[model samples]
Target: MGKTTRYRFREYHVTAVADPMALPIFEAVCVTGEERNCAAASGELHAPEELTRWIAGHCAQTGHQSYEQTTRTIVRAEPGAWQ
Candidate 1:
């Protein structure tokens, strides 16, 4: 019998929020996957969704203290995995 390899995947939601004063500030909101604990597989959400959720949550919590906002998200996938 041949040996089988196991894989894992994790997703993180990175986000950023800025103030209207032209000061670019950013933050990260991590939404990890089930296999995130595994050191093998890891992944993250695309850009748009990650940024949006981050900003929204930040604003909601902080009472929309900032203005003229921009958002961005990123996906980090593990190597040697069939995504």
Candidate 2:
């Protein structure tokens, strides 16, 4: 059998929805797991609050309920920070 991988929910960003004028818009976020060579996975949720709920749901379904949220930091550093 092949090895299994686990991914943790990172962050979510509001994208679009069926109606552009809707109060709550759909969101898309990238999730990364233990598989180093694997690419990031994306999931969509109807609302902002639903994003976190969906992530927890997925973790429970995948037998990874112990996945806890690590440090979450948003960077606004200068462009040269990448150097």
Candidate 3:
């Protein structure tokens, strides 16, 4: 008979790390009406303050009063020591 074989598996921990090379993107969309959605507004990698200002402006101009915000962030995951 052939010799018995053995295998081992290692466990790893995962966490999110920010990418220094890329900035987070911020977007906002007006959700004031039920029938249609307004064109999305983006900060294009700008800070949250900038996006908030844009949303406020949009709300004032269109009387939207309601909006949905989205933030896209670039992250990296590194494997930790085997456990």
Error of 3 at 72 (Å): 1.1
Q: What is the lDDT of residue 83 in candidate 3?
A: 85
Q: What is the C-alpha local distance difference test score of candidate 2?
A: 0.43
Whole-structure CA lDDT of model 3: 0.80
lDDT per residue for candidate 3 within 21-73, as digits (tens), equals: 98888888777777887765554646889888988888888887777888888
Model 3, poorest ten-residue lDDT window? 37-46
Candidate scoring better on TM-score of 2 and 3: 3
Task: Please report, in order, the local distance difference test score of every candidate based on alpha carbons.
Answer: 0.43, 0.43, 0.80
- Candidate 1 lDDT over 34-57, as tens digits, reads 554212111233354655676566
User: For model 1, what is the alpha-carbon lDDT of residue 5?
Assistant: 97
Please give the RMSD to the true structure for each candidate, in Å: 17.2, 19.2, 3.3
Please give the lDDT score at residue 82 for candidate 1: 39
TM-score of each: 0.25, 0.31, 0.74
Winning candidate number (lDDT): 3
